[model samples]
Target: MHPVSTPTVLVDEEDRIITVLAGRPLGDDWDEVHAEISTLLHDAGPKVGKPRKQERRGDYTSLSFGVSYGGGQRAPGNLVQGECSRTVIRDISQTKAVQRAAGFMNGCFAAYAPKLYEEYRSNLSQLFAEYPHLEQIFPNSVFPTATFNCGPRVVTLDHVDNTNVPFGFCAIFACGSYDPVRGGHLILFDLGLVIRFPPGSTILVPSGTLRHGSTSTQPNETRQSFTQYCPGGLLRWVAYGFQPVGSAKPALRRWFEEHHDERCKRAVGLFSKLSDLQQDRQAVFSLKGSV
Candidate 1:
C-alpha cells in the first residue's frame, strides 16, 4: 500500500483531531536520525529488555521514563509522583541520543500540530511547577512521559492505552529501517486507517481511545518506535488542585461532579479541526518564541 504522501489530519464528527500524520519533519535527515536512534537502541542491548512477554506486543523490548500518578500507585503526598526511569535510561550511556530522539519527536509535534503541542506543554509545565522535584526525561520535551519500543522487530496486537489522557494526544515516532509499504503500517482500528508509517515520521493520536497497533515487518528487517504521552491520572491530579481525585476537598469534588459534562465538552474542544488548522498553525507561530 502506498503511504500517505502528504501530512494529514483525521477528525471526528465534533471536529476533534483523531490523529495527525505528520510526515517527515526531518526531511533529508530522516535516514541519519533514524539510524542514530536505531544504533542507540541496539547498543542498549539487554538493558532495553528484548523479547517482550506482553501478549499485546508480539516480541520486543520496551522501557518508559518520566513521572506517572496512576496505575494503582499509592495516593500522592504533598508532592506528585517521582520519576519512573527504567534500565535503558539508568543503565545505558546513550542519554544524549535518547534526548535527541525525544526532541525530534517533540519538534515534529510542535510543527505539525501546534495547538496540541501547546496543550501538552502547558499542562506538563504546570505539573512540574507544582512539583519541582520531579525529574523530566527530557527538559525540551513537551510530554511528561515517554516510552521506547526497542525492537529488532517491533509489532503490536490491537490495543488502546486506556490509561493515557482520554482527550489528549500521544506522539509516536517511528524509527529504524523497514519497508513501510510491506510492513510498519499503523492501523487505527476505530478510524479504519491503515497508514503506511515510514521511518523517522511521527503521528499524534488519542491513544487512550484509539485501538492501534502496527503491521508486521519482514523477518530480516528492524523496526522500533518511541512514544510520548501523558496519563489521564496525571492531568486529573493537576486539575484536582494538585491532589488525587479521591483526596480532593468536598466542595471541589462537588463542583467537579456538577460540571462533569461541561468539562468533557471543553476537553473535546482542545482538538483542532481540519478547517481551522491553518488559522491554528498561524496563531501558534505568531506567538513569541513559539515551540
Candidate 2:
C-alpha cells in the first residue's frame, strides 16, 4: 500500500528549483531490493550480456519493460519485460514488465519482486498531485516506469525522454555506494542545474520534457539507479477513449489542436505548486544480520 502523505511544497536550491521528497524510508526494503539486483550485475538478469544494452546510448547496462505505442510504422501492444525495437517512442505506461522487474528488484532473477514494486509505487504515488492531469489521463491506474539500471561507475550522456507524456512526472530512485558530493549527480541541461543525487533517494523529473543525465563516479565505485517513466501517447490513449491518437476523428483532432495553448497553460499552473523536497544521502550498507 502507498504511504499516507499530506502534500506540501519544499525546494532544493542547490539544484535548479527541483523538488526533493521523502516518504517511506529506503531502508525498509533495502535488503530485498539489493539482494535481487546483485545477481544481475554479474551475468545480466533475464537474458544474455549487452543485448538489452545495445539499444541504449550510455555505458551502464540495464533491462526495461512497459506498454508502449508508436514509432515509424509500428502499432502498440501489451509488452512483457523484453527487448523493445530501436525506433520506439510512443505510449509507455506501467505494464506487466514492471511487475516482473519489480519482482527482480526484491530478489534473485529466479522470482518476482512484489515487495519492492508495491513500495516503489506507493512512495511514488504521493507526487501525483503535482500533475493533476494523470487522474483524468490515466484514471484508475499505476505509474508507468523504466528499468533497473546497473553497472560500475555508470555515466549517461545528456538527453531528453522524447516519448513520455507531457507534464507527467517520472520517479528515479538512486542506489549503490557512490559518493554524492564528488560524483554521481543528475544534471538537467536545459535548467543548468547540477543535483547532488544521493544514493537511496528518489527524485521526480518530468523526463518527457527535460534534457537530463548524470555525472561519472570513480572506477572502483559502484553506481546504480532505478527509474520509471510515463509516455505521452498514454495520455492520448486515455483522452481518445483507450485508443491510439492516430485513430481520433478529424473533427476531434482539430478541436484538441485549437485548444493546445489553454491545455499547456493548465499544465504549467499545476506544475507551479509542486513541493515536498527531500535530500536522502545516507547508506544502509549490509542487511545480512536481518536476513
Candidate 3:
C-alpha cells in the first residue's frame, strides 16, 4: 500500500485513532503467545517505574518492561499525574511477547502517520549507525522502545501521556478476556467516546496530550493491556546527543556535559526539529507538532 494511502483514524475529530492497524493478530499460536506474555508479567512482582505515581490500592497495579522514555516527571492541568523514580528493570524487552508488542506498534506508526514514522525511522537509523550495538539493544523499536505494560484490572485514571513525542501517536493493544460493555473500555474523557477495545485489537490515542483511561472491569472479567509510547524526551535525546538535555537537566548535568556534542552530522529528515526544518529547508509544518 502507498504510504500515503494507508488508512488512518485521524485525530481531527476527537483526538483519537481507532484500530488503525485493524485485524492484525497479536501473533500466531495463541497458547504460546499467552504463555510468553504471562511469564513476562508474572516472572517478577509489580516492578516500579510507571509514568504516573498511583496511590497504593488493590484496584491498580502494573509492571512496565522494555526501556525508559519521558517517565518519572510531572504534568499540569488535565494531566497532572506526578512522577517519582523507582527500580528500573528491562528484562521484559528480551521476552518474545513484549518484542512482538513493540513490533506491532512500530508498524502502526509507519501506517497511521507515515511522516512522523519516517522521522522516527531516520533518527533511529542514525542511532544504529553511530552505535551499531543499538540494533541489538532495541531490536524492534524505531524511536523510543515500546512501554510494555502488563497488569490485571489496570484501571488507568484519566491523564495525558506527557512522555510521548508531540508529533507521534501512542499505540495500544488490549489483551485478556474482558467484557467490553461491562467494563474495560478505553475512555477518551474529552471526546465522550468509549471504545469497545476487544482482545487482540490495536488502537491509537494521542496519549501525550489527550486525557484517557479505561473503565472498570466486571468482577470476573480480567483486562490486561499492552501499549507502546515514545517519550518526547526521546526525540530531544536523539536531537541533543543520544542523552537527555535542556533546562531540566540539573540532575543529568554530568552526563549531558559528557555527551552533548557527541552527535552525528547526518542529513536530518523528519527527525530534525520542525523549527530548524522550516528555517533550513523551508518546510512548513501542517499537523507536525499539533499534539
Choose the strongest candidate by lDDT: 1
Compare candidates 1 and 2 on TM-score and give the better one. Answer: 1
Candidate 2 C-alpha lDDT tens digits along 1-291: 322423222333523223433322433454344434333332242233454344444866665545455564243333444343211211222333223334332322101112222333343354343333333212222555456665654576887778776555566666556677889898888878887766555566667777889998876777766666655665565566555567779887888899999977755433322221111101111322210
- In model 1, what lDDT does residue 113 have? 65
Q: For candidate 1, what is the TM-score?
A: 0.87
The digit string of per-residue lDDT tens for model 1 on 54-118 reads 65656667766677877676532222322333445554324665566677667767765677677
Q: Rank candidates, lDDT, best first.
A: 1, 3, 2
- Compute the lDDT for candidate 3: 0.53
Candidate 1: Cα lDDT at 93: 23
Off by over 4 Å in 1: 1-5, 75-87, 90-97, 282-287
Better of 2 and 3 by TM-score: 2
- Candidate rank order under TM-score: 1, 2, 3
Which residue pairs show collisions in model 3?
A: 161-207, 163-231, 163-232
CA lDDT, candidate 2, residue 52:
39
Which structure is stronger by TM-score: 1 or 3?
1
Q: Can you write out model 3's per-residue Cα lDDT over 56-125, one digit (the tens) per residue?
A: 3224445433334455532111122123212323455566766775676666655455555667667656
